[model samples]
Target: MRLFNTNTARAGVAVIRAGSLDRSDELDVPVHAWVKRKQPWLVLPKDAEMFEDASTMEVLFKLFAR
Candidate 1:
């Protein structure tokens, strides 16, 4: 999955379980590191609204709407 910070125009990719949205440290480290480095004010692995892979357009709409 892809995560984007609209405020900073920065984005990262991560692998999360579809059912639980759990992230794997080994796979997500790079994304975590980038977030820590570039957007330290933000906390990771926080509770967030989850969408299915098919809801990508909805995600994009919501993101841009904000």
Candidate 2:
């Protein structure tokens, strides 16, 4: 998440939170939203795509290759 924020700060690129849209792990915790609340500048893409339970690299490529 910090990576996203840092890159956005320096490069002005859109932030895409790939993988599970729930932003939580198997533990059912609200991880992404929690981080967003803490770092309000961490912008989430309006078209953030949710992926099935799969490899993160797959999701990342899917997101970036657009």
Candidate 3:
């Protein structure tokens, strides 16, 4: 079971953020992937690397970037 915080719960009030839709177009596929690849550094807990970080958002961006 994935645990989420109050912010996460509040943020998901709808399928998307109420005013965030335009951000997607600002992302070039390359930049998007790069940002995603590096994102895990922000979200993963320091001691949570039990297995591959492959499924982490950071890895996804890295894969998408290349």
Q: After superposition, how far is residue 32 of candidate 3 from its true place, in Å?
A: 21
TM-score against truth, every candidate: 0.24, 0.22, 0.20
**CA error at residue 50 for candidate 3, angstroms:** 9.6
lDDT digits (tens) for residues 1-66 of candidate 2: 332332433354444454434543333221233332344575544555433232244454454576
lDDT of 1 at 53: 28
Quote the RMSD, in angstroms, for model 2. Answer: 12.6
Q: What C-alpha RMSD separates each model from the true structure?
A: 13.9, 12.6, 13.7
Ranking the candidates on TM-score from highest down gives 1, 2, 3
Supply the TM-score for candidate 2.
0.22
Residue pairs with clashing backbones, model 1: none
Q: Global lDDT for candidate 2?
A: 0.40
Indicate the worst ten consecutive residues by lDDT in candidate 3.
27-36
Q: Which is the winner by TM-score between candidate 2 and candidate 3?
A: 2
Predicted candidate 1 versus true structure: per-residue lDDT over 1-66, tens digit per residue: 443223323244233443354553344321222232445575566444433223354454555576
